[model samples]
Target: MPKKKSTFFNSVRFRIMAIMIVLGIVPSLVIAKAVIHSYEKRAVSLRISNVRNQCDILCNQLVGVGYLENPSSKVIERQLEVLSNVYSGRILVINHSFKIIKDTYGLDEGKTVIAADVIRCLQGEVTSDYNKKNKYIELTVPIKDPEQQEQQGVMLISISTGEIASSVELLERNGMFFWAIIAVAVVLISYMASRVLVKPFNKITKAIEEITDGYQKEDILVEDYTETELITDAFNKMLNRMKILDESRQEFVSNVSHELKTPMTSMKVLADSLVGQQGVPEELYQEFLQDITMEIDRENKIITDLLSLVKLDKKASDLRVEHLHIDDLLELILKRLRPIADKRNIDLILDCFRPVEADVDEVKFTLAISNLVENGIKYNVDDGWVRVSLDADHKYFYVMVADSGMGIPEESLERIFERFYRVDKSHSREIGGTGLGLSIARSSVLMHHGTLNVSSKEEEGTTFTVRIPLSYIP
Candidate 1:
């Protein structure tokens, strides 16, 4: 239970609730304090006013009877008693000599109360004090003869605030009650707001989970919000890429199985032919053995090409880059394949507009260029020619291999770079082609941040263009 509660406080809901509480409560506390303080001041003010009015009246009656001249009079005592009862506090009457002429409480009668306020009252001033914490009101007013315009005596009053103190406390309690209700409302609002905000994300998570579990077939739909839409779009794109990779992997496995099986099947048939033919002619046996060896070599080449493709597909594969003459590279590739070209009487030519130097993977680029030129020679007609061209600009070097071969069909051009894709399966097998040559060539060129392009006409010829940066960037 404590674990769940701990998680809840760490969750978005709690953080949002905490924020709302601070936003709602800090100001409320300050406002309540101000209100209580103002009530305290107003309570003191009202008591002072009430006592002032009663004291003024008593002072007038005393002046009319000349009570200060005779403090022991019964009439003045009765008036003082009435003033004390009405105001609910102490009352003291002081003469101009700063002597307590009359005291309603009688505790300070005949005492000389020579206080600052008493002296100020003797000089014809009124003063009041209010103690908010203790809750009391004190006031002093001077008695004056209107005709002579001189101070005759002073009236001082003190009032208890028992009712006001109790009322202020009750106000605080009621304010706190209202605040409690407000806090509950804020909690509910924050909870609902956080829930509403998080609903889309929850839906997204559920949809992704379904996709992961193979239950969902369609892209996640959460376009009600921009942020969620962006998340959904990115996730769906990555999902689609994974799907493509999975399909490609399955296809690759099938193709590899089929390709490997074919060579083994051919070797098996050749072995069976030797086994059945007892005392076979030496020349015939040699031919069969050569055929078996060729098939084995073909199998090895296919495996090698597959490994190369896998390396090229990786993001972190490093290139052994070197600055070498592009012209020399092409000559080296053609030199190796020239004998095969000679067997077909196909003309092999190098049309170098200018010698080009580029930073490239020495062995990989030679293999890639060899694939292009070798294909040209292998697929060309007898007495036809294969032309290799090297050209360059400030930024990039270009290699073009144009051939007088039976070119690829227009529709098949795009799929030519796919693994094990062949336009003419019979001719490909006859030429011992694994159909991965173009794919490897393209991958190698692209690894150097280059481009491989082809333009061909069916039954006429084909031209391959290779563009590579003059200097490798990485």
Candidate 2:
């Protein structure tokens, strides 16, 4: 099978750059087109206005001298010369008969003009139009004799309009240059902005990579990054969670190894004793068999505890729920653990203040409460007291088991409910505890959406409180 190649344009950086180009380029082109069109229109209108004004002034000068019928050619030539010098183009004056009366370029004298605009002006309509053939603007103003109250002849003026085209071309060139500068500046700014945006993401990625490589102790530090603080905070929180989970995994492995080793070591010792060279006595062999049986029993307890913990981690919907009287349940659990209490010489006291009821899985709840009561009696001093009490608040029932035995340290209090965690490892093993008692108890309580908490002071006593909410009860 061949590997597929990824397209570079699919990357985020490429997409961002593409967006900037589209946003920057389209508007620049539109603005350039508009500016060129506006400048061209204004230039043509101003040139035509200037030529019309000049022709009107020349006609007025001729009429004032009463020489409108046969104006001197020298006079018209002088007027055309003045206008041509003021404007940057040639000017021509023609009559209503389309005959050239005066020419600033000195080439149209006594010539009959056959232009469309000139023919229109000869019909007595005022005209200001462009001649595309010669690139000139032609304007015609009607000459009137005030004494006769009638129209005389047309005063036509023509000027080159190529200057308007040149001005529009210059504007377009400048617009292109300005947009080029803007594009360069925008590209630089986009690059800098993308870098600033991706910096925090890079830091997060590097931190994750370090974690994958088993370097999880480092904390993420990004400065001057207020815009990405939320993302950074979430990343840091995930890292902290992973660190805690890693520690938990290591502790579970260590605890399992220790639990398994004790039983296997005992089995090995017993088997060796039974097969020793000194022919094994029957009674001693029975003792060895009893030891093996006890170790097997311990292993069975550890396996049972592990299975219960797994079940508790599953969804509550999987467990069969039923309504049971809290007082009745406690009575049954204490009765079942009474023999252990008797063997240890510990007094199991029950203080029931209310007949509280809750809905929960009966078998799991019984096992959890049994473990707590048994632990209280098993670890207590001779004649020590284990108190089981029940109380109810507005929305929950509280079951508290307090024992006057070797109490836990304040620092280790929270970790007591962790799997296979024991305050005194040697003492727990001597008492035949699988060290998963409190963990199972906590999980069972959580299945009912309840909370399990413990408070203890070393050498004083320990109190385990289980609060079950009424909402969780059917």
Candidate 3:
């Protein structure tokens, strides 16, 4: 069983659920709080307004009956008694002297009610308050005397606010219940959405797992989303490249074994023939030793070429770069290979259009151009001409090698640079060719970020073009 990580808080579903909860619950709570506060404020304002209106009506009646001027009137006392009872709180009537004329509760009837609210009301100001914790609304209104054209006294009324408080509490409970339901719905939706989003990734995991277990070499054909498609495309390309490299490696090993064993077997047979002979002639002995020496040289040449190709195939980070002349480099390669060409009577020619200076690893570049020119001389018919040309544009310098050789066929052009690939196997072996020269040359040029191309026609001629940047980046 696979080990499980502490990933519940890290998973997609959990994260989505967390986001939904924040979206659903936080806003719901804020709106609920705002609504409750608004309702409470409105209810208190309505209660205070009602008390103010009730106090105004009673104050008008007191003024009409001349109650404040003569407070001992039985009719005024009865009216005040009824008003306080109906409003459900005590009422105080204070005159301009700030003395309580009559208290509906009968306790502060003959006492002075000197309060800030009462003083303000006597000066024609109205003030009110609702004490939510104590459950009461207080309002002080002016008692106007029409004859005096001013407030003659103040009427203070205090009423209970239990009903509005009870109703608001009920509404808050209902809002919370509705929000609870919405939060649950958010959780369910987030879970389903996360599942849908993560399904493709789960399938991709399975595909990779199968590959890891050494099961399939097929491309993962997932086309669910654009991101997944890009991933699959890149992964399939990498997989194809790895397979090609692996196959190439295996074929190279098989070819090396066969090639190395052939010469060794010949040497062993020749040695055994000498050993079995009682009196081997001096001439025979000399000939056998030369043959063995030739085979040894051939084997050593193959190993040396293989090593050079291996080194050339490495990354360009190892290049020993310096400023070199393109013309000089080409001249050096042709000058060295001219002696070999002279033996076969193949004329070697060089054409320089302009003198170009470039930043390149001189040794690697020289080896690469030498391989091309050498092949041109080796593969050509007797007395054929080999031409080397150098030209450059603003961006890149070019070298073209044209030879009147037995040219390559159309189909074999592409594979000609592949390692150990030979057009004529017998002729290649007879000419002491190890079949790694072109491959090494191409790799070396490519390491310098260059392009090498070939165009040829059978029995007519062949031309090779090499393009290299004037500057080396790395």
Candidate that scores best on TM-score:
1
Tens-place lDDT per residue, model 2, 171-241, is 88898899899899878877777666666767776766776788645766565477556666777788888
Model 2, position 124: C-alpha lDDT score: 62
* Model 3 per-residue lDDT tens digits across residues 57-101: 777888888888887678777877776777678888888888888
Clashes of each: 0, 0, 0
Per-candidate TM equals 0.85, 0.72, 0.80
Query: Which tens-of-lDDT digit does each residue in 1-474 have in candidate 1?
Result: 455554777876678778887888777878988989898788778777877887787777778778889876787788778767766678888888778877778788888887888887777678998776776777898787766778888888887777888998899999899888887887788878888877888899999998988934888889879999999999999999898899999998999899989999999999999999889999999999999999999999999988888887777258889889888888888888889999999999998899888899887898799999989998889989999999999999999999999999999999999999988898788877898889999999999999999999988999999999999998
TM-score-superior candidate, 1 or 3 = 1
What's the lDDT for all of these models? 0.87, 0.78, 0.87
Our model 3 lands, by Cα RMSD against the true structure, at 4.7
Stretches off by above 4 angstroms in model 2 are 1-15, 34-38, 65-233, 315-317, 344-349, 383-385, 404-415, 456-461
Minimum summed lDDT over a 10-residue window in model 3 is located at: 79-88
lDDT of 3 at 279: 89
Per-residue lDDT value at 104 in model 1: 75
